[model samples]
Target: MTKKDKYQKVAYYPGCALEGTGHSYNRSTKAVGKALGLDLVEVENWNCCGAMEVKNVDPKLQTYLSSRVMSTAANEMDMDVVMAPCNGCYHNLKKAEYDLKHDPESVEVVSKLSQKAGHKTYEAGQVETIHALDWIKDTVGEEGLKERVKNSLNGIKVANYYGCMYTRPRHIFPEKDQGPGSESTSKPHFMDDLLAAAGAENVEFPLKTACCGGAHTLSDSDTSTKLVLNILKAAKLAGADVIATECPTCHSGLEMHQIRAEKVLGETVDIKILYFTQLLGVALGLKPRKVGVHENVSDSRGFLKERGLA
Candidate 1:
């Protein structure tokens, strides 16, 4: 095993999607973090953040639900930075914290709501929330990551898809800015940094940060499929063999309805979709199955097998 300086163990908060449909992401997070010499301590009694859509249904309910996770990390765990790997969870948690801090009324309402739900109320900034990319870049620099690479994904081209949630609202804080404190653009490609940290070529697909029709899939499938097809089509046009994403919803939105997208496009765009953690694990010398490659709707095993690493 590679030995290095030990850092404080992080209390990893894997939200609903990660615990269920996004199981692969949770697995890859642990495997990649371990391989990178970081200790990921799972938060005890963690619960869902009610997702993005759920927030709109009942603001008080969503706020309390999200704060419940933070309260657990703060009261139970000793870690300071609560690492949320899911984009939706990151967004919701950050939004909850922001609301609980900036808007005092919302905090009171949420506190009452929490009492009703039998969960504890939390103050804003009680727990500093961060995304997975922030931890990956800060904890393991590019040089360290390169040294850990067992196999370079030389020929495989991936369209670095950031989607909307990864770079939106108030709380999207990646470790590195696009070009040194360049706040001119709100949208940043933090995941692309990780991709380059690995050895894959990141093609600038026109729709890299385009919306993947996110929770819209729940209400309108056809529109969601059309939106996802557009993103996938752009990836295919950019000569990418796979579309790599950080958000589980983005991955599922594009891959779950991929067959329909192929039918709509009138051509089979043979492209696989995967989470960034899965790719990171590969770069860290972990096996494909161990990183949850098999959970992907579009099998990327052949692509990995062709690379002489899978």
Candidate 2:
């Protein structure tokens, strides 16, 4: 079938952050899906996909964790596709799929873990793992997004930040960089395309794939602060009024460091940080509150209201 048809009713995996700090993304993603008449059946009894941290302890264990989630979607939910909004979760699930297919050691470990955990072993090719950006861009192309605009994000300058985990060490994501209409790892533009369709003026952002230091935000606060500040400053220098984020860890790091930069370094940078999903929800006529805009640490309510978006 067509791309839209394939993604019309996929299993949703929001991960742990979505239920906590990333609730706004969760809300807006669901809102956008509903507005577009798409069906999102959440993965049943889903658990953590070994989000960026756990893999440091044991790669195979992390593989098993992600595999179990995919197993549930493919075996129990009977779904062919699993959609994850979190970059970490998306990356881990994709990594698991790759490991299970190519590495016999991974297969053996996952099989043993499945038996011990009382679940079916997740073999590769059982389900397709996709990010939220892929879900929107593939299903509702730029043209489709343009047709659904209720309150256009006109004149709102956005710097689309895809973050590092989405595209790094590219072999895991073989689907990307294939041809036109496919995602590019070197210069990803799915978020840029979607926001532009909603009438947002996407700035010339050079740090789209930069690391937000989310992995070591706590362990190495100084380094993460420096990294986040660089991203924020770069966006401002690029004439962006807001930094559009796709990952919860990146979004939180940017917000937290924006404060830290002002308080500790006394380097105040006046740029709002928002989720791309939240901006899309507003453009689709959903109120800011509806998309949990108020929940964000970096307040953009006034700025959005002044632009006639709130």
Candidate 3:
């Protein structure tokens, strides 16, 4: 079938962050999906996908954690594809799929864990894992997005930030870099393409895939603050009024550090941080409150209002 047919309806895995700090992203993603006429079935009784923290304790354990989520989607839900909005969830699920296929040790651990956990072992190739970006870009495409735009974001400047988890170590994401119409890990443009379709001007953002140090944001606050400040300052220097984020960790990190930098280092960067889905929702003529824009730490309602978006 075509890309759109394949991804029109898939299992949605919002993970833990979505219910908490990333609620805005969760709200916007579902709102945008509804507006686009796409179907999203939430994986039933879903658990955490090990994210970046759990893996540090044990790689195989992380594999098993992710395997459980995919197992539920494939075995119980009878779904062929699982779409995760969180980059960490997407990466971990993809990594579990890769490990189960290539590494015998991972297979052994997951098998044992499944038995103990009273669930079916998630074998390799049982289900395909995709990111929210893939779900939108592959299904809707830029042309589709353009046709749906009601309140065009004309003159709005955006700096699309994909963060590190979405496109690092390249091997895990095999579908990317497969030529035209495919996402490039080195220079991902799915967000850029979607935002552009909404009539937003994408600035020349070099740190689109930069690390916000989300992994060590708490352990190493100074480093994460520095890294986040760099990204914010870079966007401002590039003439961007907003930084469009796809991942929750990166979005929260940037917003938290933006305040920290000003309070601690006396360095202020005046750029609003917003979820990409929130931007798309507004462009689709949905009210800012509908997408939970008010939930974001970096208030952008005034900024959006000035541009006639709110």
Candidate 4:
């Protein structure tokens, strides 16, 4: 089947952050999907997809955790595509797919763990994992989005921040950088493309894939704040009123540190951080409340309302 056909209805995996700190992202993503006529079947009995903790401690164990999610999607739900909104979850699942295919050790460990955990072992190629960007871009292209835009984000200037995990250590993502009409790891444009279709101005922000210091937030708050500040400052300088994000970790990092940089370092850069999905949801005529715009620490409800995007 064509990709357009495959992505119309797929398994949705929101990971842990979506349930907690990233609840707005979760709501916006679902709201956008519904508005676009896309179907998202939540994976049954899903588990964490490793994230930073398990991967730091044990790469193999992390593979097992990520694989478990895919196993449920493929074996139980009979799904062939797994869409993860969080970059961390999408990355871990993609990494698991790569590791299980190339590294026999990861395959063996995951197999044993799956059996011990009382689930079907996740064999390589059983399912495909994609980020929320790919899910929308592939299924509903920029043209599709333009036709669906009930509330155009015409006046909103945005800086698209992809963060590290989405494209770093790029060997795992064999689908990207495949020439024309494919996502570029070095300089990703999927988010830019989607927002532009919705009538938002995507600024030429250079720090698109730069690290947000998400991994070091607890261990090194100062570093995390500095990193986030740089992104915010750059976005503001680029003439962006908002910084659009796809990952929950990156979104929250920028939101929290935007305040932290002001309170602690007294270095404030006035800008708003919002999930790209939320922006799209609003453009598609979904209410600001429907997309949980108020849930974001860097509230954009009034900002969106001022422009009639709410």
- Best candidate, lDDT-wise? 3
Residue ranges of candidate 2 with Cα displaced over 4 Å? none
Can you tell me which runs of candidate 4 are displaced by over 4 Å? none
Model 4 lDDT at residue 230: 89
For residues 194-262, write the lDDT of model 1, one tens digit per residue: 778788888877787688787887688788888887888889989998788888898888886687666
**lDDT of candidate 3 over 1-310, digit per residue (tens):** 8868989999999999999999999999999999999999999999999988789999899999999999999999999999999999999999999999999999999999999999999999999999998899999889999999999989999999999989987999888899988889999999999999999999999999999999998899999999999999999999999999999999999999999999999999999999999999999999999999999999999988999988
Of 1 and 4, the candidate ranking higher by lDDT:
4
Cα deviation of 225, candidate 4, in Å = 0.7
Stretches of model 3 off by over 4 angstroms after superposition: none
TM-score of each: 0.90, 0.99, 0.99, 0.99
Across residues 86-193, which tens digit of lDDT does each residue of candidate 4 receive? 999999999999999999999999999999989999999999999999999999999999999999999889999999988978899999999999999999999999
RMSD (CA, Å), candidate 2 to true, equals 0.7
Candidate 2 C-alpha error for residue 81, in Å: 0.5
Residue 182 lDDT in model 2? 89
Once model 1 is optimally superposed onto the true structure by TM-score, how far is the C-alpha of residue 205 displaced, in angstroms?
2.1
Per-candidate count of clashing residue pairs (backbone under 3 Å): 0, 0, 0, 0
lDDT of 3: 0.95
